[model samples]
Target: MASNIPKFRFLTAAQVRRLHGTLIANAQPTQPALLESAVQSPLNIKYYNNEQNLFQLAASLPEKIMKNHAYQDGNKRTALVAADMFLKINGYKLQETPLQTGNVSQDLENAHVAVCTNAWTAEELGRFYEQSAKAIEEWTPEILAYRNEATEY
Candidate 1:
């Protein structure tokens, strides 16, 4: 039944840009989500399908959207929100975290490990963009378990 839920499909890289534009328009300077959609890319969908590994997918997100000095603050937080939303829509019981934490880079690193196990790395994550979805049709169940058990709210 969980699988029956229609996926929240994100179509094009341009759409992600639009999402970022919306966030920037709606938020104040310090608020996260200001430039979130810019980090989006079609590669994310390809990796999610191929790896069936949310952590790798999450880790790959920042490289796609974040630019040095692009946002004054909240870029990582915005990425986290986007990743959390992505996981929830795909039937994953995601662990919750304090929104807009001060330690975003560490948290993002942790998020990557939780999803990809030892396989999570920026270098490997880079490959997802070019890979075929058929590559990971049969993944181990352990790979499905998010490493950090999500907290019950």
Candidate 2:
């Protein structure tokens, strides 16, 4: 039943902005309508569309946030962290993606660029997220410390 599907913790539009400030740059929004809608999309999906996979639900953050170009700049960077934060809040992390030459980060970056260019659809990115997802316990020192410190936002 759809009711049995777990409700995942979501980032607020406020949090998305906070993240944009923290990760991308410290700035105020002159026009925030699109950013707000992007951040809230997952909630709409959970309650109305009923996605069951946490990773797939998490994928919506970066997808919409980037696609909408939620910020004046660094929309790509913000979209990445926003999605990662969503996963972290709900007890997950994306595993290190593999690459042929062995530098996984490049592979992930390529995916982001492809998405930005519309070469890959949101569903493709969603699958990338789902396939890479791992429990927090499974993570090592971690991709970086951005999500480590606590904040009021």
Evaluated with TM-score, which candidate comes out highest?
2
Give one digit per residue, the lDDT tens place, for model 1 in 92-150.
42333325345443545454444344444444643432231122333335323322222
For model 2 the TM-score comes to 0.77
Full-model lDDT for every candidate: 0.40, 0.69
How does residue 31 of candidate 2 score in lDDT? 55
- Span of 10 residues, lowest total lDDT, candidate 1: 144-153
Q: Which stretches of candidate 1 lie over 4 Å from their true place?
A: 1-8, 11-39, 42-52, 68-70, 97-120, 123-153
Residue-level lDDT for 70 in candidate 2: 56
Candidate 2 weakest ten by summed lDDT: 144-153
lDDT of 2 by residue, 49-87 (tens): 777777777777788888888567887777777777778
The true-versus-predicted C-alpha distance at residue 20 of model 2, in Å, is: 1.6
User: Which ranges in model 2 have alpha carbons more than 4 Å from their true place?
Assistant: 1-3, 95-102, 138-153
lDDT of 2 at 19: 70
